[model samples]
Target: MLSTRRLRPSKNKPKLPDGVRIYAMTDIHGCAHLLKQMLRVIDADLARSRPRYAIEVYMGDYVDRGPDSRSTLDILIDRSRRGNTIFLKGNHEVFLGNVLRDPSLLTDWLRVGGLYTLMSYGLAPSPTPGDEERQHLVQAFARAMPRQHLEFLRKLRLTFTCGDFFFVHAGVRPGVPLAEQQETDLLWIREEFLKSRQNFGKYIVHGHTPVRSPELLENRANIDTGAYATGNLTLMTMQGSSMLAV
Candidate 1:
């Protein structure tokens, strides 16, 4: 694990274009209903403001620990088709892809909320799946997953930047230059990123570590709000330096 203490501020920072309003959401887990409600709120807020342009950035963790992973992905896929949106990859997604490729990893996946994800696809969740059973589950998932959802997961971005804000699935590694941070850290870092107050050049907005409420820090903002467990999904509205949860 990387050290979190005595971190320094970043030098390379990028800003979002002028007059652009962005709605950044993170860590839906498998709460499709919450996601739908949040989107409606965002749409209404955007319409009231009427910015020159708007973009929706989803910071990933679309599945696991919740009842509707399949429906959540379906909603996100449909939303992507309607307008501008950016989908990011979370640790859960990485695990999902890995299990799809190597069934042996299913045991580890199941321990960390993958069972719910499997159930969402209408597949049986087993502690010890035989070779034949593993193959059947894989095939079932393949058949259940829509083409667009597969593409969405396959092409999910690791990081996104807009007007002085950097977005990632998880927090960035402290002390490492933003451009040089590793994918492993970006997707899975916890204490190091959470404990450090070092300026990451841009305000990093991320989700992975769930919190009871949104955490606003000098370097980053954690908006996960544990939607899968808490039923409170956070949707943040950002315009220049002004930001608020709707």
Candidate 2:
């Protein structure tokens, strides 16, 4: 069931710097079309509102599953150059980096939409590539990936923190201090972190689990609306003590 409802601000709001506003979105999964649309909306909104300080935070999974993965990265890279933007690494991104270092992981990556990402770069690998073919494909991918795009992916942040919000790709581990959280948990934790109702010190703004709608809980806001499959690329904004989604 696709959720058509808009996300409302949570009761436990945290104040950001007086003039700063954050526009955060997540789990793009190569949905370049939706990404483009959302950016336009955000830009228009900012222009209309005239906020003093604006920062864009992307919660990762920029490649695979949807069409135009390469184009998706291109858009993000270009956008980052234009202004204040932060990109975080998702589990899929970790998998991609690992596969690039070790071709044997290619089959595993493909099982979870890595093939589509390759297609975006115009490299079509055989379903069961032999050792030689795998190496060849790896080389091809290295050659095909734009230098800036590769650097962007390599330098993606694991977590970003603002006044009272902790932004990560996935939820943080329960009982762990935000500063002490492990990289693996930051990029991949699910059930343990999701089910916990305990205070995480600061509200965690994340996207990984695909909820039907935006999960605007007191402790976290999950804005990953599953754009790759659902066509609903959600964006969450936090300004001062208020949050909203469109």
Candidate 3:
């Protein structure tokens, strides 16, 4: 059965009362149907003022796994153009960056849901073009992506802090100021973040590790939840220190 469970607000992240309601979602992979439904839920929530969180975000892995990555990106890009959207770079986005920088890595990337991107772009079963054609295909694909999406992907913050919350696609390195956190940590670190005893100062919310449900805790929350094949996208909302999931 399709779930429509109601989530209560969290005490750590606050909701916006005067402006947008501030909704954050993670790891869509490529499930377009759930993306559509989530968008509807956000809109409907805002329209009815039901716990009211308006700003919507997708915390990476927007493509791959599912068959509708292209359409999924289309919806995100369109909604983003209208304003009040935040798209973070998940490990999958990192894969895109890597492939564009060096197509030779396509084989490795394809093993982790990247095959969908090549197929979406109408490419071959084998990795990608060889020495002579790499530049052409890479440049074309780069140019084809929406400028804003590229900019968003490129400029994504390693760590984002608002109120008492800190967010990264993965987790940050231990014992480092939020400003000094490394890119490798933001895009990859997992075990260190999970094992650290000292508080990283703020509640870190991340989405690198996949889970069946939103992993909410005092230190960090893993919201990846593998939505691509399951057709379920998990989102955690913060309203004035109260946490809620939709």
Query: Which candidate should be chosen as best, given lDDT against the real structure?
Result: 2
TM-score of 2: 0.95
Number of backbone-clashing residue pairs for each candidate, in the order shown: 4, 0, 16
TM-scores for all predictions: 0.90, 0.95, 0.82
Cα lDDT over the full model 3? 0.70
**Candidate 2, 140-198: lDDT as tens digits:** 99899989888999999999999998899999999988889999999989999999988
> How accurate locally, in lDDT, is each candidate?
0.84, 0.88, 0.70
Find the 10 residues in a row with the least total lDDT in model 2: 1-10
Off by over 4 Å in 2: 1-10
C-alpha positional error of residue 134 in candidate 2 after TM-score superposition, expressed in Å: 1.6
Residue 107 CA displacement from its true place in model 3, Å = 1.1
For candidate 1, give the lDDT of residue 234.
85
Candidate 1 at 244: error in angstroms?
A: 0.4
